[model samples]
Target: MGVQWSDAADGPIGGDLTAVLAYATPAGGAVLTPIAPIGLRDRDAGRLTFTTSLGFGRKLDRIRSNPAIALAYHDRAHGFGASSAYVLVQGRATIVERPDREYLETVVGPAAARFLGAPRRGPFWDRWLAAYYADRVPVHVDIERVVTWPDLRCAGDPVVDGEPLPAGPPASQAPPKKGAVPRVDVAKGARRLRGMSDLLLGYPGADGRPWVVPVGLRADDPRGYELSAAPGLLHPGARRAGLVGHRYNAQLVGLAMRQHTGWLEVADDGSARYAPHTDAGFAAPANKTLLLLTNGFLARRGLKQAQRARAAEAAT
Candidate 1:
């Protein structure tokens, strides 16, 4: 139904900026975006609306900060002309709340009820969430301002000067994840393990904290990675400590993790539980690892061709 483009602003530090899924609150009188092109509408004259495929709660903070937004859409009709990478689109953005059943249905389609966090065919089957937001809102980003590539100097435009957005207080990564972490990132680590088909895990402790321990893994295409292990990967301390915990692993579980990040841990009884890591990359003293033999064995039974090779080496 619509096209999406990358967010051009990369923050003062200039890293890959994560695009936001939000809209401005009309009542709040935030940075107002137009509802139509060429100043067709006046200030607060029209509404801006857009969406991020995430939950309303997840995007609230961003919208609070940068109510003035620009959207990127693709002109599928126009080709990139070979030498170009990808096409672009731009528009003023805002978030809107949908109160009517008919309207929300039009925007969200058949599963509208579900995404509104509604359940089907239950005692409250027909009911929709009354007010499901700590903020209680849905974003409506209207397409008003249109800026495209060449216009913004092909998106290579640089910020002349601006104050930095103060970093938010670093929140704890997880009090503890009750369910599961994103398997997508795990798939990424798994692919890296495939390449090191000849190495075994090396650590100081047998077990301290469990995490996704990536020593030096980076590759393309991540999928099917679990928190399991390889053989001979355990340190003397880890070997002894692991006996106390359950499976104490997930597929190629990270080892000796310190604080929280994104990882899962299994208990000794073949029950895999999730534990969060605190640090960013795979850290040590409390880094994660594969009991060389353990990881190898699991790989042979659970992983495919590439992991099998790594597993084979671990067996030794």
Candidate 2:
């Protein structure tokens, strides 16, 4: 199904029923799951719901403590060239027990139809729905914020969008400009590299389908990064890694900083030969931190100005 970019409640998802839910693990990492949303859209409440077998996993237990979560809907191809759409919904979730019969009927039945690739359910669908509801429980996701990129092609560009054009004469190619300031020091912590904390890596799974994994850069070494989950968490054979993010934000930090390569090989021996320092990826960690600090400063100034304007209006 084709996806249209709009500000609707469900516009970002298009006809995609599957999503990757990321939630915090007890040890400060994250766990990603492939789940099917069972058509629970409370537009007014800004919530979406899905169901999974009650005893099938330990994700329910993780939800009880840390509510901060993110659900992503990514369609790598819409048959429109290499263009794609990605949406991230940072939200909170909870498991609801003893749901009403009507709610179950409204959600589960249609989800099964979509999963089975049937436009309309036949007579036997009722039995399938009954079997699905036997041990599953609903997980409510209240959306806090949603961010989407209509075209992800820009993620591969060497220079970030909105930056100045090449400065040299047309005949010769100009080298990409470096950040003005020195690299900002990253604090000591696991997966806490100031501006380069989280990144999305995409590669082809064994089935040849596009697979994305989220990872964090090591604070101590900019060249190295750690996967939030296990090495083969999503797909055991996913070895080539492509970092995906807004081109501008990505320019500020990453391992492949400025060089745009087709794919970086991830070693099966738990090692990786990242792009050399000449590439922006090596310098990205420091540059990213500086950019973040600059953005923060500007944001604070804007907030203060807004506050002052409010006070002035009240005085008048």
Candidate 3:
């Protein structure tokens, strides 16, 4: 049976302007990325949806291979409702590669307007954003489990729905052997994340799907950044993981985010250290016009890249 959300859980799930989506990788690791789940498509059935550009073909391909994924609603800043609960939704995702124009206009358009304001409509603006607005793919998640913590900080015991919590981390292939040394400058990475209010770490859970939890910087080590979280949330071992720090103004304007992929080591004593292997991020323009322009540019480029990759795959 599918998970049913209580009113407490529903508020954050349907109201939050954005969510952190974690999808499994073939190697049993997960990629944590931020997504705007515009609104709940089906509240009673626990169906949530998000849209991505075709340019993110690689991520879509990953989902097609491993549908197990999770969504974490850990932020309440500038959202639709008031909630103290932090929600984590574990589910399977199905992709709709090319939604028709009617669906985009009737379904997605109104939902986006509710949070982001009305769409820009003009001869010049329409032409400029044709690809950006039109060439989107929607991914729907069928909820399997919903975990809710009474405190926004996720500090206390969580109430679970749907599937039961696993006894322990599931057995999986060993993480790739990489040098423990940090590849990116530790100080620079830490400095970049300093301004962000929400910092999260994502790793594989006992069910082999990724679990995302809020984390704080405990200290800086020569090897990596040491992080701390609520007790009993993390498994003790060395594994592949991802970290993201992000913040946004009301209505999701003026956004800044930083993401890192790395190796995480958790001590038996619950101490955790992350050694960053790669780093990448971007800050969205605060001006709405400029933001749309940037989105159009990125979307066009991504569409081309997706097409080229598809051609290559066909040839192979």
Candidate 4:
């Protein structure tokens, strides 16, 4: 409840600016990438559309091979204590190349109206989007399933083709998670992952949507943990990366909050095992000391940055 916006009006979709499109790769892993939808939250219809270049992108290939995809959005403006409200949309997408004037005016027109501050006339925004839309495509994601955390009251069920989609387990339900990734609290999750020297980040690539690339995570004060991906793996408009070492590291803190039960134990032989809460002899002490040292380093770095900025201003 960081900022008060009626759930009935906005639902859990957040604003147009706050969403990530996720699709499965040929290898079965998932890549969560950001997207800006042009349409308003249509809870009843259970469908929303986004505008993207129809160029030779990895997502386009994945969609052509498999239309089943998911979009996850969380309102970062507001915070619900440790957790944030989020929505997961599982759907099929249809990409229309060289979309006609009629479809843009009728479908994506009204959605673009608010941002452009103009009516849905083809000549206006159509030409504007043309520069990017030329040979590009508009992907209309048909919502087959919609899941939200901290469910809020809405006007109607998310419907598809005149029928309401079946409800899913509440987001709070942990469910049976596979893998050795031990669940941890949202706050400590990223910090713990930052301790790892080498981790893998999955994003869309020529190989597949969830192409895995190794990365190193280091914590910095004021900025939190910073992730550096492999060379050429990071590019503009494709900043989001999924943690590969374990799914428990959690995604962006603002997206979904997780609960932790125990931590992972790494042996001298490089073998890793989940440590129960009762096991207190492992690296708990060393881990705590390391985290404190990292925090101190970050604080010093922040101070240095601030001093440099001040020095530049004085010189000017």
Candidate 5:
């Protein structure tokens, strides 16, 4: 009833549990923040476990009264109720501006920009965009053997099933013909040029280097995009046509380039990996590739990039 920690080889480690904990949410309320209980260590060959939520929020009562706090994952909450059964992990939590890269690599490892809430992820080509990583700050949450509430059930769908999403659509969506390709049609492909954040531009007079820009200049259809340089950053073939028709085709292309929004891959290590280019995604094994939902425009983006490169070179 109180706390149980260590267990044996087959059975879960328990009985060594130390303390009970109370969680503090970001916004602080009855809601949850999808708190993931991760056991990060200094090595790779160790047993690593974690839990991810669809989306949850937390309350910050302990942070207000007492900074020193730890708690088991909450099962339910109200004005006055039994503290949600959980393993209490009382550790120091603070954002560290100065981080040793080696230490970070050991504990948290690396994650896609999406996890850190960056503008874009993929193979970022712009110097300005790449520099954004310079000011990054890392969070450190010290570890203490908290609770192991395997019996405690969560309110939302916290089941750690085979795949993240549910099985699939109804059987009706299955392939109808024998030789027909079962299309993953969810991908609408090419995003419109409008509001397209021109991360970089290699137009004339910006020197050999591409012009740097924020998420400036929207894509004005496939024809071209505006630049953000003093003179402006415009793509060489910014004069393409039928952007309206090309949109659905280029949607996925834009996504793969956006790096920030590349396709998610369930890695062998059980962590999700993201690739900025289509080649990286395709090069993976079938099991890995099966996780990705590719749109037809991925190829088109590569072709388009090549054409633009040739056009830029000829003009030079």
Candidate 6:
């Protein structure tokens, strides 16, 4: 059975500006990325939607191959939501690769404006952001399960609504070819992420779908940060994993985020540690104009690169 969103789940699901999206990697790990889930596309069916640029070809490709994904709504410091509940939605994604312009302008545009303000117009802006605005794809998730905690901290026992979770972690895939050694200074990376308000850890679950949960740093080890989450949330074993730490102001006008992909070790006693192999992050400008400019520039560059890559593939 699908999850039926209760009033408690509705607040954050319908009003939060951003949610942490986790999608499976071919190597059997999960990559955590933050996305703006504009709003619930269908309340009764529990259909959630978000859009990404055509420029993000690699992520789009991953979703196309493995549709199972998860979204965690763990932050409530901004936007219209008033609920304190932390919600996690696990489902299958259906990507709308070439939605018509009318749908983009009428359906997606209005919902975006509610949270991001009106889109920039004029000939110069339009020409500058053509790819960013016009070349987008929407991904809709059909909710299979919903897990909620009483508050953002996930302090109380979770109340699950919908399908039952699998009994254990999924069969492990082949280990990544490369070694999982930390690529950056573990201590430096931990210090930078420790202050963020929302920290999430994600890994592949029993159904081969990604499972995400809010976690905190239990201790700072020389190799990595020890992780603490609700009891039974962390499966016992080592696996490829991802961690994201983020914070944002009202309407997502200002933000700082850090993401890392690495190896996670969970002991039989439930202790966990994450050693980051790679780290990447950014701080979005507080000024909307500057942010839009940055987005436009990046989108244009990414689109061009994607096109070139596609052309090269065809030439072979």
Per-candidate TM equals 0.26, 0.44, 0.95, 0.42, 0.25, 0.93
| Superior candidate under TM-score, 1 versus 2 | 2
TM-score of 1: 0.26
lDDT of 5 by residue, 64-131 (tens): 33233332332222111233333223333444436556654454333322122223335532322332
Better of 1 and 6 by TM-score: 6
Q: What lDDT would candidate 4 get against the real structure?
A: 0.42
Residue 253, model 5: lDDT of 26
lDDT (10s digit) by residue, model 2, range 1-316: 1112234325445344455666654433344544555344566566667776544335666676776666666533211113255565655678775666676666665664554333323454433333234445788776655555454321322211121323321121122144211132212322232333234544333322223444444323443333343343233321333443222222223232222122233444534332211112333243644543443443445445645765788999
* Model 3: residues with Cα > 4 Å off, grouped in runs: 170-175
Off by over 4 Å in 6: 170-175
Best by lDDT: 6
- Note each model's CA RMSD in angstroms: 21.3, 19.6, 1.6, 18.0, 23.4, 1.9
Residue pairs clashing, model 4: 54-136, 54-137, 183-260, 184-260
Error of 2 at 90 (Å): 0.9
Candidate 5 displacement at residue 303 in angstroms: 35
lDDT for every model? 0.26, 0.43, 0.83, 0.42, 0.25, 0.84
- Across 120-140, the per-residue lDDT of candidate 4 in tens digits comes to 236644544343333335786
* Clash count, one per candidate: 69, 7, 0, 4, 41, 0
Give the deviation of candidate 5 from the true structure as CA RMSD: 23.4
Model 5 residue 201 CA deviation in Å? 48
Q: Residues 1-316, candidate 3, lDDT per residue (tens digit)?
A: 3578888898888899888988876766678888788775586767888888787788889899998888999988778869889999998999997687798888998888888788788997787777777778788888888899997778878999888888886443365666756899999899888878899999878787678999998778678998999987777888888899998886667888888888888888889999888898889998888888887787788788989999999999
Between prediction 3 and prediction 6, the one with superior lDDT is 6
Model 6: per-residue lDDT, tens digit, 1-316? 3458788988888888999999988778889998888775586776888999988788888899999999998877666899999988888999997787898889999998898788899998998888788898889899888888898877767788788778666554445577655667888888889768889999988877688988898777667888998777788888899999998776576778999998888888878888888898988898878788888898899888889988999999
Model 3 has an lDDT value of 0.83
lDDT of 1 at 239: 16
Q: Candidate 2 deviates by what RMSD?
A: 19.6
Q: Indicate which candidate wins on TM-score.
A: 3
